[model samples]
Target: MPTVRVTRYVTPLREGGSLPGVVEAEDLGTYVCKFRGAGQGPRVLVAEVIVAGLARLLEIPTPDQVVLDVDPEIARYEADEEVQDLLNASAGLNLGIDFLPGAFGYDPISEPARDLAGRVLWLDALTANVDRSWRNPNLLVWRGVLYAIDHGASLYFHHSWPGGTGDPVRFAAQPYDASEHILRGYAAEARDQDVVLGKRLDDDALRSVLAEVCDDWLEPVPGAEDADALRERYVAFLRARLDGDRGWLPGEGAA
Candidate 1:
């Protein structure tokens, strides 16, 4: 991923608790930057990058990610005190996704193609993402293409890491309840895609994906001696879940 210096702080996204802002970078491109200082913390950004990597392997159309280097001096020019505070606090590397101008929020009034829906559902299930319900789909329609975003809420086990890296096997055994998934109608498609999807993320591919994350982004854990150890724990968790039995996998629903 490319790193860009923030040239301007545009606006706060009024919705999410993380207060991700629209910012202009030195590359003359606009991006939605997730602040490192957000209450949910850097772990969410780690999840975002890793999941985006997985989506890339699956051919999912997600926004290109970049690391935004924020400058504290820019905060003084901000009018909104809240956004100013966020900028002041996030004066270093933050998460940025290419801003899709005029993208509309996804509403599940109709179904998308089965294969695409299946790939999406499978990705969510594999990551244990619980956020993509109808109310907050976290999906966008840009230039008539569907794009996935905001994966910070996935990988629930990592929140326990301040104490220790939790058991990967327990996460592997955890069952996904897709009854309320935005793409629940295409559960069968997710299952069909699952046969080949897990194989796509072999050890090497997983390492490359984890490498996208910078060492500093990983929060320190009790037993984790360094960033490589922290990354290994994530890889171990993914391997366990991917190779585990399909018992937790969702069943078919109406097409």
Candidate 2:
């Protein structure tokens, strides 16, 4: 992977969305970063970086995300009052990710749906991702290839955590289907091989990948007081997930 220096923090693209920073990439592409010291905490941006890095390790088609330093003076939220309000409510959210420019759609319930669903199921089990749904599949269809995106809502279990209060929304139960459907026109051999579908996502491999990529991003920022502790917490949480008793792997899902 090539390193891209986030030398400047241009004006944030304050469109209506979850993350705050709308930045200009360095000859790469436009990115929507979670600015550091933004609303909530550095944890949000850090989590995004960690998730994307780990997903790549799991062989998932995830967009590249990285930290970019910007002089606070150059940073300005968009002019829209509602956007600013959203920004104000959530400040210090700059961390950029290249937004792929293209058009794609999911062919669910069709032949290709099985492969797509399998990849998605593996993604959910690995990261414990909970956002994919009938409304927000989060999987994209860019040029006919399935690409995963928007994982900020996963690790934290922002909706329900530390307690089994409600049902786990496995993104429309894509992980539990029996027939294993795929793209209608795909060859039988290809479908039988299940190559487009991923495995359980080796837990040890996942941890190693996370530990490697997150080292730089884990460094404490100048402003955030709890940055170090937060980073450590995230790493430890990931370590536990990779080696814990979650019983989320493949056939282990039935256990």
Candidate 3:
């Protein structure tokens, strides 16, 4: 992944609990950065990168993600004590989601084509992402293209790693309820692409996407000694989900 140095803290996006903020990078690009020091911690950042990588492989439109090298020194200029604490906590690498200028939040009134919407629904189900609800769509529209964002909520299993990274069999067999999904209206269309889409997640493709993830982001956890083991765990969980069961598929894999 490309690394960008944060030159300035633009503004805080207080809408979310993680307190994400817009900032300018050395590359002259702007990004909404997810702080590694946020209450949610670096796991959410890892989830963001892994899920977005999969989205790109699945041909789903999403913001470009990069690694932001943040310096705590910038926090000194901020007036808000709360914001200052957050900046000071997130001292090193953080996740930077490309800021889409003029992008509008998604609404049912401007739904995408059935196939595109269904594809998104399908991807969310596969990842067990529960964040794409109508209450917080996390979907954006720019230039008429629907883009998925804020994937930190996608992989929830990692939070349980304090006990040790358990076997992925359960995650693979897990079922996803799409009743509250923002694109639930297109669930049926998503079913049609299930088989074809599953085929695209071959080992090679999965590895390619995983390669984009930075080693620093893969914090070691029980059952995974090193970053390579951590990557394998992610790969194993995904491959198992694709091959283990279709329980997570929307409509129970009906096409």
Candidate 4:
């Protein structure tokens, strides 16, 4: 990912728990920056990079991401006490998503095409993402194109960490509850998309996707000795999900 220095502290986007913000970077570009110091920590950032890469591979539309270098000094000029504390805490590298001006929240009333919706559902299932419900769809309609966003909630296994990393097979066997998914009706198409997209997510492809994640965010847990180990763990988990008996695919037998 390209690195950009944050030039100015902009307003806070108070939509979610993490409290991501809109900011201006040295490249004269505006971004929605997700801070490392947020409640979810760097793990969420790691999920964002991995999922974004997978989205691109699946031909899903998404905003560009960059590594934002935040300076501690920028916090001094902040007027809001809450925003000031957040900026001060996030004094290092953060994840910056290219701001999509005027993009509106997704309206399920006018759903996406079957194939596109299928692909989105497939991607979410493959990653064990549980956030894309009707209550809070992490999708945006930008200029008539559906774009996936806020993927930090995907890959839930990582939250369990050291203990969870030990069993990739278990995660592979895990079933995704797509009944609540926004695009649940497109299950048949999702199954078809799985057959196609699944083949593309081979070992090499999975490695390439994992490569986009920053080393710092791949912090070693108790089970994983180093960043490389952690990367391998992620790859193994994904590959298992793709190659194993995919009961996780939402449909007739889906949970």
Q: Can you tell me which runs of candidate 3 are displaced by over 4 Å? A: 252-255
Rank the candidate models, highest lDDT first. Answer: 4, 1, 3, 2
Model 2 weakest lDDT span, ten residues long? 176-185
Per-residue CA lDDT of candidate 3, range 104-205, in tens? Answer: 999888759888888899889888898988899999999989998988888788888767888789999898988888898887888889998889899988
Q: Model 2, residue 76: displacement in angstroms?
A: 5.1
Score each candidate by Cα lDDT.
0.89, 0.49, 0.88, 0.89
* Candidate 2 vs 3: which has more lDDT: 3
As for candidate 3, its clashing pairs are none
lDDT of 4 by residue, 134-229 (tens): 898899999989999999999988988955477889989999999888888888888987778988888888899888888878878877878888
Better of 2 and 3 by TM-score: 3
Q: Residue 46, candidate 1: how far off, in angstroms?
A: 0.3
Candidate 4 Cα outliers beyond 4 Å, as residue runs: 162-164, 253-255
Per-residue CA lDDT of model 1 for 175-216, tens digit only, reads: 988888888787887888787988899999999999999787
Candidate 3, TM-score vs. the true structure?
A: 0.96
Query: Candidate 2's residue-wise lDDT over 1-255, tens digit each?
Result: 333444343455443245465556565556766654455455455556666776675456777765554444333434555445544444332466766677454546534444444555554554556566545566677766677776665565322322322223332222322122222123232234333332333445545545533344444433323445434444545544544443443342221
Q: What C-alpha RMSD separates each model from the true structure?
A: 1.3, 7.6, 1.7, 1.5
Q: Which candidate is the best by lDDT?
A: 4
Worst 10 residues of 3 by lDDT: 246-255
Q: Which residue pairs in model 4 clash with each other? A: none
